[model samples]
Structure formats: C-alpha cells, structure tokens
Target: MAATETVAERPDYDPVALAESLASAADKSAKVLGDFIARQAAAGKSMVTDEFGLTQAFLELAAKMLSNPYRLAETQMNLWWEYSALWQSSMLKLMGQSTTPVVEPAKSDKRFRHEDWEEHFLFDYVKQSYLIAARWLHNTVANVEGLDEHTRRKVDFFTRQYIDALAPSNFALTNPEVFRETIASGGQNLVKGLNNLLDDIERGNGQLKISMTDSKAFELGVNIATTPGHVVFQNDLMQLIQYEPATAKVAKRPLLIMPPWINKYYILDLREKNSLIKWCVAQGLTVFVISWVNPDERHAAKDFVDYMLEGPLAALDAIEKVTGEKDANVLGYCLGGTLLAAALGHLAAKKDKRIVSASFMTSLIDFTGAGELEVFIDEEQVSSLERKMSERGYLEGSHMANTFNMLRSNDLIWSFVINNYLMGRDPFPFDLLHWNQDSTRMPAKMHS
Candidate 1:
C-alpha cells in the first residue's frame, strides 16, 4: 500500500490549492485566446505555406527510405536491440541495483543537468529513453541511401529540430524540476507562464519572439558603444565615425573598419575593456569605422555595387579629407569583408591604390565549403527570398536573426522557451544577448 502511494497522495499535497490555480489559469488562457483573435482580425494576414520547401525534401527522403527496405530494416532492428538493453538497465535500477545508463547525453547538452534527472529513477528512465530514440532517429535519417547533398542536409537539419522540440526536458510533466515547481506553487507558475507567452506573442505582432534577455537593459553610445568618436562624414548609405586621438603621435596610415551591414557596427565597440575600437585609439592609430544605415523602403534600390561605390570607396575619400592621410589600412568583417574583397578587384581594374594594407575577419572569398549555411543557399530558396523581399523592399531584421538562431536552436531558441514560457521566469540581463537581439534590416537589392 505504501509503495503504491504517489506524490499526490502524500500529506504535503493540497488539492484545494491546485484547484484554485487551475481556475486562475483557465481565466488567463481565455484572455490569451481573445487577444490572439483580436490581433488576427486587425491584421487579417494570410498564412504562408511551406516557405522553406520542407515538404518536398521530406517526401524525397520517404521515397529513398521506401526503396531501401533492407537498410531501413537493419536500422529498426538496431533500435529495438538498444531499447531492450535500456529496459533491462531500467529494471535493475528500479530494484535498487546499480546499472549504467544505456545512453548518456553529450557533454555539451545542458538539459539533463538537474540532480533529479539522475537521482530519481522515473526521470532517469525517461531521460535515457528519449536519448536512445533521438540517437536512433538521427542515425537512421543520416544513413538514408540515395538523397542528394542538399536534400540530405535539409532532412538532417529538420530532423534535429523535430527531436529537439520533443525532448523530455521541454515538457513540464516529464521535467522533474518543472514538475516540482508546479506542485509546490500549486500551478501558479503555469498561470504566469501562460501570461508570459501571451505577452511575448503580442510583442511580436502575433508571432512568438522569445525574449532572450531584458530588452531595456542597455543603450547605444552609453554603457555600450561608449568609445569617444565624432561623425566626421556621412553619405546616403553610411556614417564615417572618427575616434578622438588617444596619443599625441598618430600612425601615418589611418585604420578604417568596414563592418557588415547585416548587423550594427556597435558590436565591435560593445564595451570599454574589450572594445576593439578603444584599443585601436590607444595604439596611436587614427581609427575610422563605417556605421551602415539601418535601411528601409527609401533605400531599397541600393545594390551591392552602390554599397561599394558609396561604402568603403566613399569612406576612403572621406578619411583622406579628414586626416590628411592619402593611404589607409582597411579591415572588413564577415559580409563587410566580402564587399571589401570585391572593391579590391574593382580598384585593381582601375589602377587605384588608395589602400595600403587589407585584413579580413571571418570573411569568405570562396563558396565551395560554405558549411551548414549552404542548406539555405540554393537557387530555389534564393528566388523565393527574392520574391518575399520584393514585397517588403528589404529583408526584415527579425527574419535574418531568426535564420541565424535556427543554426543553434537548442542554445538560442529552445533554452529560452523553457526558461521564459515553461518556468515563468524573466530572462537575465545580458549585454551580448542584448546586442544579438538588436538586429538590423538588409536592403532588398543589396541582400539579393
């Protein structure tokens, strides 16, 4: 009888409190629904269908698996054998015997960090069961015989997303910490969690934008981007910021930095102690950084060639005018580096030699080994994006941020979901995250 008793049967459990919390949660849930309905009615936006072409990719994967029955059978048999081992191990653990977990999470996986995940028998079983299934799914999909490279990559990427979403840690009932919190708080946490979800969806204009950190925690040119600088010149496209000289003797060649327009330039000058801009000033070099315009429809016609002619090329002419320096050392980061490389080729063609030295940071000159980002770079997807951009005049900043976030969904996306929506907690203030969420728009012509 004692063995059969559950946690709810214990003296500490209060049914009355649980009932009250549930009632409150139901009221809040109605408010959530009503707000959602009103927002939809106001916007009257239509649903976008399969913008990523995931359906076609999955169908192809299914066809390949169906044609290779033997391979599928072998993979299924392997999974069954693993499940059997896990059952035996779990049985031993339930009998108060020491047994090894059939599978362990990777060292970097933080979902299973709570002590209850290991200390409690039921949760330990759930964790191992989920891990085993996740491994089997990944291996099976990865080994599918005859899919093209692009289709295979898309399948694998989405497969990881599917598994990550279904992880036991994500759901409250299966997550020991959340379960304990629910019981202790009599489900008030859940009511709060629902409120947080509604607030976030409303903030995103009917889309869910999970808050990674407190949005009000930082400001431009204050706590961040605090390096002393003067806007020495401005073109229609960018502002040339010249930092105040830190030393009496300045270097003969000024240092000009061209940052990627995909993000704001303040990323390089985030804070004083670690700011590259500040360090350059202290190095006795007159530094000039290009702050790209946060473009809108008016600037939609600006293309890559326009960016080159008006961006670094224009900055070069401005730098020469400001500091009496005819030649300057140029550095570009990421997309900025790509643009600089193109400008070099253009200048070479015209026999111009205003740049003395050039440096690139995480810049790509070749596309053959573009890594995981290649999954979204095919002609079909590019054309689809072009059509979308034509409607908006530019790629939305949030869309670009969402794409980058998908690359590390577990870290950037799901973790916050559990913390902010499942646990009913406010995100901690983080400067780096603040910077990341402060995304900038990309002009349609330049982006295309």
Candidate 2:
C-alpha cells in the first residue's frame, strides 16, 4: 500500500465562494460564445465560396487525373516492375535458391521499414507499396495549383494521417510477423487481444481506448513517485511536496519544480531509474515539487492568474519556510513552464526575487509558423468550444487529448485501434505513454 501523507489547507483560498464564482464565469463564457457566433454568422460569405483560386485548384487536380495519366502511369509501371522482381527473388529463396531482394527501402524511410518486414517478401511489398503510395499522394497534392498555402498544409497534414492509418503494418493479415504469431499461438493472442479490447471498452465506457497505458502495471507514489516526500501545503489549485534530503548535508540552495497542471506531476518521478527527483536527491539537492489539482466543480473558477498566485507563487513561499532559503532554482515543463514565466514576471514586477535560476522543457515561446493547430483556431471553432466550456465550467481533458492526437492520429489513434481491436493485442506498457493518457481538465477561464 502507498503511504498517505498529511495535507495542510492554503491560507489564501476561499472554499465557500468557489461555487458562486464559477457560476459567474460560466455565464460570462456563454455570453462571449453568443456574441462570437453572431459576429461570425454576420460575416458576408465564407472564403470557400468567395475564392475562385480554391475552385481552380480542385478543377486542375481533377483535370490532371483525366488528361495526365502519363506521370501516374509511369509510377504504376515502376511499382509493378519492382513487385515482379521481388516476387521472383522470393520464389527462388523458398525453393532453396538464395537471393537478395531487388528493391530496398530508402534511407529516409527506414523507420517504416523494419528488418522483419524484409525477411518476408510479401511483407516487404506491402511496406514498400504503402510508402510509395504515401509519397505519390503527397507529391500530387503539393503540385496542385491555385490553393492557398494554409489550405494546402492542412490538407497535406490530414492526408498523411489517413494514409498512415491505412498502413498494412497495422493489420495482422498484412503483417507477416503478426500472422505467423497468430498461426503459431493457434489464435491465442487474438483471444487475449479480444479480452483486452473488451476490458478497455468497459473501462472507457464504450469508446475505443487510444491510450497505451496499462493502468494496472503501476501506482502513483508506490512503484512510481516513490521518492520520499511529504505534502507540506495544499490549496484549491496545488499541493506543495517537500522531498526528504538524500544527502547528510543538502545544498544551501533548494530546487522548486512546477509541472503543467494539464498533467500530473509524477511524470518527473515515474520510476527509480528514470525519476528526476531521485537523481536530484542523489546530487545532494533538496527538491520541492508542485502537484496540481485536477479541476472539477470546485476548481472551475480558478484562472491562470489564480494558478500563478496560489500555485507556484505559494510553493516558493513554502519552500523558503522549510529550507530557510529565500531563493530556489525553478524548473517548469510545457504549460507549467509558461506559468512559471508568468510567475517570474509577476515577482520581478513586485521587486521580489524568490527564483534563482530557471530551466524549461517544451515551453511555447514563439508562435510564428505556429504549426498544425492553426486550422482549429478560427472564430467559429472558438465559439463552439467556448459554448461547451461554458456549460461544463472546464474544458474536458478528452477534448485537448483528441486535438493533440489528430496531429498524428494514425499512430496515436488508428494503430492502437488495430492492435487493441483488430489484432486483439493489449497496449504496450510504456511510461511516457502512461503520462500522456493521464490528462487533466483545464478551467474554462484558464482555457481562454
């Protein structure tokens, strides 16, 4: 059993007023949604209708499909030639004559081409065909005329996702290794995989579970988060955990870690070998970490400002009290790093320097060339999301997780669908995958 630590309530938080405050915020969010949707509806005509350039792009692509079979025809003939040569080599090897394949996967495409795939000629063909199809489709879309840059990129991103999801490697019949395993085991793996699928469906309440965490394999602060620590302070937003000193005499300066509230803090202290907290302790550094609260009805009112003031800001004060040091080295990860930046600015503005040095991991500082999320940022989408957030008072964790998963849906989603359902295989147990699955809700105000 995991040890239970004592918790102390935060001095600044008011539990009684939380309900009233959240209701007011939710009402405001709803009003914003109404105004936003009205404005969007009032806008003259959509770009898709008004823009002739987009219409021309589609027409050109369709015209090429009919008139210019030469490029596609040449490509098809080359693939058939490669397949014929490979088939001949496979037959010779099977009949006791040794021969190497005529075609090999390219250097850049090595990740998709596994050694096991090359061992079997049929698997090799499937792998090569999949890669070839992807490349052809990508080039075809890239060369299409008149489409604007943004639309082209979005189309390309989703097309890759679709192609990848349809990869032969994901299915047992198309994958020689999985087929062989099914035959050797007399379909026992499939039976076990089916059971795994059923369990996941039941666990997720009928949704095909995409996460790769084997939830039964580990427990927080038991097998993981096992670094000796005491929960020294708690608030509506976070818990300040003070890890025990690993050395007889610790560093005069302490370390304060702030992980993103979107994820649980145990990611840094996953297991003994991988735990950053344990590694720091071994180096004779006293470390204190902030474990964020998963928002529900009670925490729906807390905004980013609330988090900065009561979260890391309060943790710094508590760390100072415990270690008798006014300043501590601070480190933050992702959104946590963003929050830390806000806290630092606040402290600097107030002329209080409690943070000595800072380290950040995967923090978003620049938005230029802002990446794939731009497609979902239009006024209509924001209004839709805001309306939902207004009703719930917090944006569902699944919403954020699904959005992130779309960036690589084939691997993050469909691959698992094939494995867990079609192949009947359970999710592979991995720490990083586990952390990703353990998502937390964001307050509506903070989400804004």
Candidate 3:
C-alpha cells in the first residue's frame, strides 16, 4: 500500500530581477569602455597612426583565441548572457511583470586576454569619426567647385581612402575562415548531392552502354555519301552542321547560331525533339552554326582581336556569301556573346551596318557584379595566364576545361572522384560530360 503524500506547489520563476541587473551591468560596462577609448583617442591624434600595429596584433590574437575551445566557450557564455538578458526583459514586459529593458551591450570577453580588442574598439570609433569628417571635407571641396589640381588630388585621395575603408572585405581579416568554411561546406554538399543524382540517372537510363551495332551503323553512315545539305564543318576550334535548303528558295535573312566557347554548341541542338536549329530552319530561317576552331599549340599566338576577326565575323561573312543575304541575324552565347558585343562595338565605331539585329543569351556587357569570376580576373592571375599563353603557342583545351571545372568542382570533379575512386564505379555517360570531354584549345593570343 502506498501512502499518498501531498506535494508542495513550486514557486514560479521570475527572470525580471536577473534581466534588470544584467542590463544595468552591461550598460555601465559599455559606458566605461566607451569613455576609456575616447580618452585614448583624445591622447593620440589618430587611431590609425597611434595603434595600427596594435590593431593587427589584436586581429591575430582574436583568430588564435577563437580557435581555442575554452576561449570559444567563454565567448559563447558571454553571448548567451547578453541574449538571455534581452529575451527575459522582452518576455517579462510582455507578461506585465516589468517595464521594457534597455538594449543589450556588445559581447566582449576580457577573459580571452587580448590587448587588441581595446585597440580595435578605439580604432573603429576613430575610423568612423574620420569618415564623417572626410565626408564633410569632400562636401566642402565640392561646394568650392574650383579647387586647384593639387587640392583636388588630395580631396580625391581622401575620398578613395574613405570609400575603400567602407568596403566589406576590409574587415574580412577578422573572421575570414569562418566565412570561407561556411561557403565551402555548403557548396561541397550541394555539388556532391547533385553529382550523385546525375550518376544515378545515368546508370538507370543505361546512357553509358554503346552497342556494337549502333557504333557500326553510325560509322557506316559517316563514311557513306549523305545529302550535300548535311555538311558537318570541322576545324581546329569548332564543329558545326550546315543545313542547306533542298529547294531553290531560301530565307531572305540568314541567322548564325553562336554558343559559348566554354561548352560545345550541341546543347542548342540536343536532339530532334528539342532542336532549336531544326525548328528555325523549318520556320523559314536559314541557319548556320559557327563551330569554333579547337585551339592547340600552333594557335597560341592568337589574341582577342584575332578571335573577333576570324571566329564570329568569319562565320558571318561565310553565311552571307553562302546564302547571299546582305544582312544576317547574329546570335551569341556567353563568351561568344561577349565577343559579339565587342565586335558590335568595333563595328559601331566604324559605322558598319551589315548586321540587322543582335541577340545575346546570358551575356554580360558591363563587368560590374561579375561575382566569383572576379577572383580569377585580378591583375596577378590574368598576368600569370598571359605569361603562360605567351610561352605556349596556344592555351591547352584541357587547361581551359580545368579552369571551368574548378568553378563548380563538386559537380565537375568531386562527383567523378566519388564515383570513380570512392564508389569504385566508372563515370556515367552524359551528353554534357561527352561535350565537356570534347574540349577545344584556344589560340594563345585569343586566350590571353
């Protein structure tokens, strides 16, 4: 038999007192720290002049401190305290237990033992103050509107410094690895998953299987005399099919299909089911595709100017000559698009009006916000590439392919790595992969 014991009711917990005390302590700490920094700045003419080394030292110290488990734990604890204080005060006020709380203070841990934090704090305050000062200075100069050359140059220098300092990457030295790790981890997972799915699809669809009969039949067809209209134009840079109309009648205007040099042109004519070129021909548009010359060591000396003259422009001339159309509809894709834009600019400068209408697919004209490509396009990287191209007659097709592959490594390289090395399986046959493997070389001058 169990004796029934009466349980005493537990008292309700009130976080209001704790929240108020924390809020007061944080406010006092912030004021004291702010005052101390003010005094330090007042003593020194400028934060940058007085404590640049200290600032750098603090940054290094912060990196080392964050790497330590105990220091990280302390940071977390302090952050939690600040967050809890804010949360409790908000909740208490909502529950009518207390008034709204003051804003929580910035979480700084002295226990981490770094002189840099104080220096960093002072530096930031001074930098911000200088920015405000610079802005006023700029406005004053602008209002004067007749500053001397030297004075204008000084103003410009200050403006540049102020703007450059505001750049997000300037403070990136503080927590760079954190951002990098976050980006790399997410990108790796996404690419790995996508590649696995692609591999699975390739396996299920039996895309890799090449039947002997099919191979024999395709080879036989290639050898046999086909219709004169079925012309597969092959060169060092490009491969394209030129479809001529059976009848004497042809389209009034000929349209040239341009694809990104980064990838083969076959994406535009994947199959009979979804062939843009076939559809255009059927719709009374004379279609011609410019297969780029796959470059090799022999073509390394080529440059951008050479590509403009020989690649799209050559195709345009050939198309006009073949079809006898004075004006042609020019279509460009990606890099091809960029080349076309440049050609158009060159033509516009010369007032050349042979082109009727220009269409660009996923093409960029202005280099602003080019995103990830910017990392590889800086002076140092471009210079190195130029040097390599100069040494070699042409840029290797494999090198170009590798660069593109690195841009999306998880999908391009890692998937194959996992399938071939980890899973011990052969690469699944994909049209895109097939085209990717069929890379073309760039003339050295063109590539540079």
Candidate 4:
C-alpha cells in the first residue's frame, strides 16, 4: 500500500505540455535571433563611426600580411613550378608514357609518409597536388584582410577543419595504404567490410558506428576498473565511490577525482597498470571518484545549477563524512573540471571552501578561440538543438558522440568506415577506444 501510494504521488509528465512549452521556446528563439541580428547591425555601425574598429582591424591584418608580399609571391611561384613537374610526370603515367624525374620537397611534414609514395606514379601525383592546394589555401587564409582577431581565429579554425576533411587519406580511392589493402585482401575485405557496415546500420538506428569495441569482452569493477572501491554515497546526480586505502599510512588530504559526466568515472581506473586511481592509491593518498548517473527523463528538468549542487558539492560532503577530513585535494577533468570551477566559485561565494587544492586537466574557462565548433553555434542552430532535445527530454549519448565525431571526422569516422566497410577488417580491442565508445547521456536543460 505504501509503495502504491508512493508511485501514485510521482509527478505525472504531460507530453502535450512539453510540446506547447517547446513551441513557445521556439517562438522566443526567433525573437532572440531578430534582436541579436539587430544588435550586431547596430554595433557594426560603431566599427565604421565611433572607433573605426573595422579600419583598424584591416590595417593590422594588412601589416601582418604585406610585410613580405613580394618574397611570399615569388616563393609560392617557385614552389608551384616544382610541383607542376610532378603533376606533368603523373599525367604522362596516366597517358601511358614516361617522363624524366625532378627534385621533390624534403617533406619534413611527417603526415606524407607512405612507403615509396613518391615512386607510385598515381599516388605521388595525387599526394603532391593535394599538398600544393592545401598550402595555397592555408597561406591565402593567413593573409586575408578585414577580420578582427576573434573572427580571424574562428575563420582559421574552420578553414583547417575544411582542409583536413579534404585530405586524400580520408577517401578510400586516394589513400595508398587502403589501395594496397584492397589488393592484398583480394576483395574478400570488401565483403567483410560490407558485413560490418550492414551490422552497424542494422543496430545503430541512424547513428554512425564509430568504435568497434567488443562490449562483451569487458565488465565494470571486474576486469577493467579492477581497483577496490565501494559506493559510500549517492545523490540524484552521482555516486561517490571511496577506494580502499592501499598503504598503511595515507595522506591526510584525500584526493577526489571528478570526471566529466559525459563519460564514465572508471576512465581514471581503466586498467590496473594504467589506472590513475590505482597509481594514486599506491602513492598513499585516499582516493574518491564521482560516478555520475546515466540520467533519463526523470532528470530531464535538471539544469547546470542542479549539477553544481548535487554533483561535486554532494561528493565533497560525502568525502568529508567518509574520511573525516574537512580538507581534501580535488582533480577535475575536461567538462568535469569546468563544473568544478563553477561549483568552487559558488562555494567560495557562500564562504564554504572545503576543497584545499584544485587541479584542472584540459578544461576550458573561456571560449575566445573555440575552434570549428563555432560553426554550428549560432542562434538558429542552438534553437534547433533545443527543439530536438525538447522532444527527447535529454540528449542521447549516441547523439552527443556523433557531434563530437563530426569534430574529427577523418580519424573517428572515416577510418572506421574504411577499415570495417571498405577493407572488411575487424578492429582490434583497444581499452581507450572502448572508453571513448562508452558515452553518457546529459539532461537537456543542463546541456543547453
């Protein structure tokens, strides 16, 4: 009867209400877009009027580029003629003829390494042509005028993304290694690759198959995260895991690791040898880690503020209770680090500084130079994302993983496509790759 009453007391979610709310938000987003564009137009007028910021910006760009314009052009021209010879020779090979050899670039650029790539008449031509085009595009962008520093940085970042996407290695036909593999495998590889492709398509539900990690080969807290730990505390957001002390004498300052909620906490305790948690235990420090909950619709309404309160703050409270230590050192990784920073700020504001020291690993405090990600971050794009999230209630881990894979399409996306789809090869079991594949969902409100 108690259980039944508890179940009945639970909040009743209304899909219709959610849809109406989303429609209203969409309407609001359109207004925001209009206001944003108007504000930009108004501020842009000041660039021409009050400060001449645009003129100054261009003048600075001009000074940076035109300092050695003549020498730059001459060097470019010479480089072009040199590559032209390679192209001419390659064209001869294509037409069933032969031509004399010419000097090639030393290629301190390590990415061009393919055994006898220069000797292969077809690949050599394709490779050198790509290099020349890439260099020209990069240099042209480097010298472009009329962009302010921030705008110029975004342009440069996106330009690099485009150039990387254009790399010959990304394509099955252009890549020399893939071509060799195709021959060596005698087309059986294509069959295997097709099978892999079909399997992913059949299972993936419209998501790209990135990692080929065999999930059955690994189990949590047994083979992978084998370090000894028990859940001492848990809240709506996460579980506070306190690892057993390895040394007889441990440090008074307990270490608490806060990994990004986007991934599992066991990344720190991946393997016994490579596990940072195990290493810290050996170093005679009491270690604690936060294993964030894989939230569903029940947590959809939770926001960043909720994460700050229930995540690190709750963990800190639990750590103090478990260890009887008022002060402890903290390590925050990536997105977790960002959350830690916000949480620390809030705690400090409230005069409750329990964390003695803090460490941030590869975290962002500012997005002044945020790379190609800027391309999809305009008002319209965000609104579209929110609408999608509103329908789902939360961002699926697969969806999040897809967006990240788009950031490095060549390595994370196409490499697998070539290996599993074109060459029909199986991927080896890599622990890191497995962790990467194991993504965690985020609440829509928090993610936004």
Runs in model 2 deviating more than 4 A are 1-116, 119-121, 373-376, 406-419
Q: In terms of TM-score, how similar is model 2 to the real structure?
A: 0.74
List model 3 lDDT by residue over 240-291, tens digit each: 5576664466678888778876566766664455666667766767777776
Is candidate 1 or 3 superior in TM-score? 1
Candidate 1's residue-wise lDDT over 1-448, tens digit each?
6666775564464668767756876776677667777866675644555667898999999999999899999999999999999999989989999998899999899999999889899999999999999999999999998999999999999899899999999999999988988777766677678777877876776677888999887888878899999899998899999999999998989999999998889888989887999999999999999999999988989999999999999999999998888899999999899999999999999999998899999999897988888878777788888988887799889888988999999899988888887788889988788888888998899888
Evaluated with TM-score, which candidate comes out highest?
1
2 versus 3: better lDDT goes to: 2
TM-score of each: 0.92, 0.74, 0.49, 0.73
Q: What is the C-alpha lDDT of each candidate?
A: 0.88, 0.73, 0.53, 0.74
- The 10-residue segment of model 4 with minimum total lDDT is 45-54
Q: RMSD for all candidates, in order, please.
A: 3.3, 15.2, 20.2, 16.4
By summed lDDT, which 10 consecutive residues of candidate 2 come out lowest? Answer: 1-10
lDDT of 2 by residue, 1-448 (tens): 1233212221333434544544554565465555545654675323233111334444555675557677667666866776677667777866767786564556664234456687665676677667666676777666655566766665566567667767786787886656766665556555556556555644543444564767767778778789999999998889999899878988999988888888889889988999998999999998889999889866778888999999988888888787789988999988889889988899999998778898998887566656887755655567767766777689888778877888877668776766675566667888778888888998888886
Give per-candidate clash totals.
0, 1, 18, 1
Model 1 has a clash total of: 0
